[model samples]
Target: MSKVRITQVKSVIDRPERQKLTIKALGLGKINRSVEQENTDAIAGMIRKVSHLVTVEEI
Candidate 1:
């Protein structure tokens, strides 16, 4: 599978619970933190769910 890097660029404060959990599941909590994940449909869905809170780049 291809790899993608996910970076938490925004705070989770006041965000929805589901979005917060998605960020955690992505291995990110604090701002500027990053996690590398496989570029799969499931992961892609999670990224899309919280797109406003993060930045994604192909790696």
Candidate 2:
């Protein structure tokens, strides 16, 4: 499988609890933080949940 870089580009302040949790599940907590994860269906679903709060790049 391929990998993708998921970077938290926005704050989770005032966002829904579900979204906040989704960001954390992606291994991110602060702006500018990033993590490389497998481009799996589960990860893609999480990214879709918080797409506006992050940036994704193929790695």
Candidate 3:
């Protein structure tokens, strides 16, 4: 399967708790932090939840 690079492009401070948790769950907290994950349904859903705070790239 292909992979995706998830990067936290924005700060989580003052954001919703759920959003903060989601960022951490994706292995990111600080700005520009990134994690490589499999391109799967679950990961896609998670990305959708925080689309405003991150950037994604297929790898």
Q: 19-41 in candidate 2: lDDT tens per residue?
A: 99999999999999999999999
Q: Model 1, 1-59: lDDT tens per residue?
A: 99999999999999999999999999999999999999999999999999999999999
- Winner by lDDT between candidate 2 and candidate 1: 2
Residue 34 Cα positional deviation in candidate 1, in Å, after optimal superposition: 0.6
Clashing pairs in 3: none
How many clashes in candidate 2?
0
lDDT of 3 by residue, 11-43 (tens): 988899999999998999999889999988988
Q: In model 3, where do residues sit more than 4 Å from their true spots? A: none
Question: What C-alpha lDDT values do all the predictions have?
Answer: 0.96, 0.98, 0.93
Model 2's C-alpha root-mean-square deviation from the true structure amounts to 0.3
**Reference-based TM-score of each model:** 0.97, 0.98, 0.94
**Which candidate achieves the best TM-score against the true structure?**
2
Better of 2 and 3 by TM-score: 2
Candidate No. with top lDDT: 2
